[model samples]
Target: MVTTGDAAPDFTAPLANGDIEAFTLSDRLDDEAPVVLAFFPGAFTSVCTSEMCAFQDRLAAFNDLDATVYGVSRDSPFTLNEFREQNDLEFGLLSDYNKEVTDDYGIAMDFADLGVHGVSKRSVFVVDGDGRIAYSWVSDDPGVEPDYDEIEAAVEDLS
Candidate 1:
């Protein structure tokens, strides 16, 4: 898996912020702000919803640290937009519908019991201005959540 000090793999995916738009990770890197990529298996699920809402609750803290945060999932842009609206998420949600980004990041997983496959694991990667990952967290258990305090500290360090 990608870890601290490793260069983050840049990707372009459909980003939903009440609208569908192309989001390029490298483009966001130009401003020298830390980028938080929170990967979840799917949108609108209980755990995913809680995780996204938690991030939304702490969004101002991330913004104060000049961090750009995005929630990623295999859901389509349409589903993501509706999820954002329902959750009142302030940050953008990226649609990794093809699962390329999730696979590239080495966080892809399967829900074999449900006959679902190629979804993202619950993970979080904090990339600093240098495009290097500053913090990494991955959980095989979908119910688990990342340490929000740790992520905030990671972004603060980058600033």
Candidate 2:
């Protein structure tokens, strides 16, 4: 699994923020801004909804620190777009439909009982401007959410 100090794996994925657009992680890094990649299992689920809404609530704090936040999942852009609108999420949602990005980050998991596979394990990574991971959090229990205060502190450190 990617940990703090490791180079964040860069990837280009479809971003859903009302509209689907191409997004390249390196482009954001080039701006010398910290980026928060919050990976959730799926969109619209109870736990995922709460976690994302929590991020939405903390969006202003992250912005104050000049950190860009994005939610990542294997959900399709259409579903993600709806999810964002439904939750009033201001951050863009990345569609890892192929699950490649999830695997690259080493946080992929399976839900045999639900017949789901290759979904992202709830994880959060703060990537500094240099493209190195500044903080990392992973949870096997999808119900758990990252500590917003800790994440804000990590981004503040970058500033």
- Model 1, 63-117: lDDT tens digits are 9988999999999999999999988898999999998899899998898999999
Q: Assess each prediction's global lDDT (C-alpha) against the native.
A: 0.92, 0.93
Please provide, for model 2 over 28-53, each residue's C-alpha lDDT reduced to its tens digit, 9 standing for 90 to 100. 78673799999999999999999999
Report the backbone clash tally of model 1: 0
TM-scores, each model vs. reference: 0.98, 0.98
Model 1 RMSD in angstroms: 0.9
Error of 2 at 12 (Å): 0.6
Pairs with steric clashes in candidate 2? none
